[model samples]
Target: MRAISVIVVLAGVLSCRAATPDLRFGWNEVDYVWDSPTQRESAIKSRHFLPEHNLPLGLARWKNKLFVTVPRWKSGVVSSLNYVDIDGAKDQPLKPYPSLKDNYVEDTAKEIPSNSSIVSVFRVFVDACDRLWVMDSGLADILGSPNQITGPSIVIFDLNTDKLLHRYYLKVTDMKEDSFFANIIVDVDNATCDNAFAYIPDLGGYGVVVYSLKQDDSWRVSHHYFHFEPLAGSFNVSGIEFHWTDGVFGLALSEPRENGYRTMFFHAFASTKEFCVSTELLRNYTHIDKNEAFHDFKLLGDRGEGTQASASFYDISTNVLFYTQVNRDGIGCWNSNKPYTPENNPLLFSDAELYEFPNDLKVDDEGTLWLLTDKLPRFVYRSLDSNELNYMIYSIKTKDLIKGTPCEN
Candidate 1:
């Protein structure tokens, strides 16, 4: 009887392990369609084009259009923000958002008349109210001696019309010279969009900036959790060794509570630990300096010994937080209500070759989770083997993945 009981317990454990679903492939070997030949020639004539350096980094879907941002960090600065039609061909051509004529097509060294538009967007969020909030880092040549041409700012546009609505620049006091505004998450009132809050992570400077849409004000919040763990900086991806000391790269917000508050989960890029703080504490700028505000932070748990992540998204429907585990070359998930343990948080999907570095993730309104993997390590350590399909975007049904986990209903 004892032997039988042990066998039953072992079988149950095996079943649970086998129940974790593999991420479904939506698109494979995706490639961006470059600007028209005439447009490229014109851009080259203006001394603002480079063919080899363009790389897609940030991604977000709005309605039938899928948006992508290629920052002016490593190479040319032609079309920094563009989108492709979802219903189009597999290798859909990317068209500039709003319109190509609206953007500054001059040289990268030249300044444009309107700083309000997206100078260089690293990440953008499409809110519940159909507004696209973009984080314009305003930095060109990010790796080769960064320069802050325009101050970092938050810009919002009506997704339906693609018209600019608001632009709030970060004050010098709110950001450091070394600041790299890479990721942002928005919290909006369900009924109204006026009362909204934005959280931007300054990955390079080691802090988080909180922006208030109602007040038109912003503040910086610093904590030890925002800094990277030095020992965790070393990384080995696809047999390439490299190191980065990025801090606070990813942020995800939980569903609003009964009191209309949410929990903010964030983590550093080069660390395995995750931390959380209440949105209530962050919204109260009037009392942010108080010691109580500092003490509200809680360490969730470590991901694993050498695991690191880039982008994370929380699906309110399933109460599951999905994140890109870059080192693991896959996506990892956890039920926010469950204890942040290895057993609770498991690798939902993994593919060393296909998921070289799953850099960004988003949960669309259609109940599908979208992912973008841009062989980032290969791009950085050595030149990307363009002949071998370097960048890929994939999607998986969120409910299908959470079925057997604690997030399941």
Candidate 2:
């Protein structure tokens, strides 16, 4: 009778364990592919076949279209901006933005006018108001000898109508000759698009620039936090070891508080440390130069070695920050309400084959997180395997990711 009771107790425990549902990380589906030679040739020809270099760095979505930026940093390409129709197939070709005639191959002048169009764009941001913000670095061949075609500027366009809304040039006083405006984040007023603020990170100049829509003025804010740590400069991605001194590459904005102000979280590409500052302090330009005014800038914590990130996006509804861990070949997440520690911020997904180097992350209107991965190490240090997909775009539900961690609440 005791043996029978033992067997029944074991069976009950097994049944309880079986009833528990298995938790999953998240389901990522490939939305676009840019790996085949035919695809590369097609994209190159679509852009007028200016320069053979075709590598996607930044991504944004508006309506049913996906916008991808192909920086001229490598081969001085003609069209720096391109878009893909989501309604088309995964292998659909990329079309130049605005128009193919606007991006001419012969217009390779040393200093193209910023008012003409997009000279060279490193990254782009599509706001909630259906406005696309293009961060034009205004420099060509960034990886090689950079040629300043025009001064760095922000070009705003109405995505709904496909019209140029405004073009605000960054003052020369706020930038250096080597300044590279890489990433940008737009902060809009509550329930309105007017009186917006655009924060841009000067990755090469080691500073942050704030542009006000209401004032039509801009200011450059410099802090030691923008610089990279020496020890974290070396990176090993996909078995390729490299050393980069890039500073202030990624930027993200938290949801606005009761006072209609948001917190800005940023990090250097060559460092594992994350830092943040309130937008209120940044908007007040008078005290930005003062050392005491930067007291609000706080060092969140280190993400540990081999966790350097390229881009980050914060979900307002979930209050969770999602960032791409390039070196780890996956994405990591941290709950703003919890401590920023390794235990709290776990690797949401890490795949050696699927995620070579997740370079960009953006959140869309439907609460979907989009990621763009380009095997940058292979494209730069080594030759890309044409047989394998070099560039890929993936999307996963933000709500599903939040459920994978304690941030679900």
Best by lDDT: 1
Tens digits of per-residue lDDT for model 1, 31-79 = 2344467766766576566544566788898888877877776645666
Highest TM-score among the candidates is held by which one?
1
Q: Residues 1-409, candidate 2, lDDT per residue (tens digit)?
A: 2322333354345435322111111112112234456854775666534333567788898888888887775653657777887665554556677754444332346755435477777689998788899998777766666677777888898888888888888998779666778888999944778889999998888999999988899998888999888899998888899999899988999988878789999999889989999899889965655768767789999878778999999988788899998888888888899887877777776766666798888888888888888788887888665445566677778787667465565
Poorest lDDT segment (10 consecutive residues) of candidate 1: 20-29
What pairs collide in candidate 2?
Answer: none
Model 1 misplaced stretches (Cα beyond 4 Å)? 1-36, 44-47, 105-107, 406-409
- Total colliding residue pairs, candidate 2: 0
For candidate 2, what is the TM-score? 0.86
Give me the overall lDDT of model 2: 0.76
Clashes of each: 0, 0
Q: In candidate 1, which residue pairs get closer than 3 Å at backbone N, Cα or C atoms, i.e. clash?
A: none
Candidate 1: deviation at residue 319, Å? 0.3
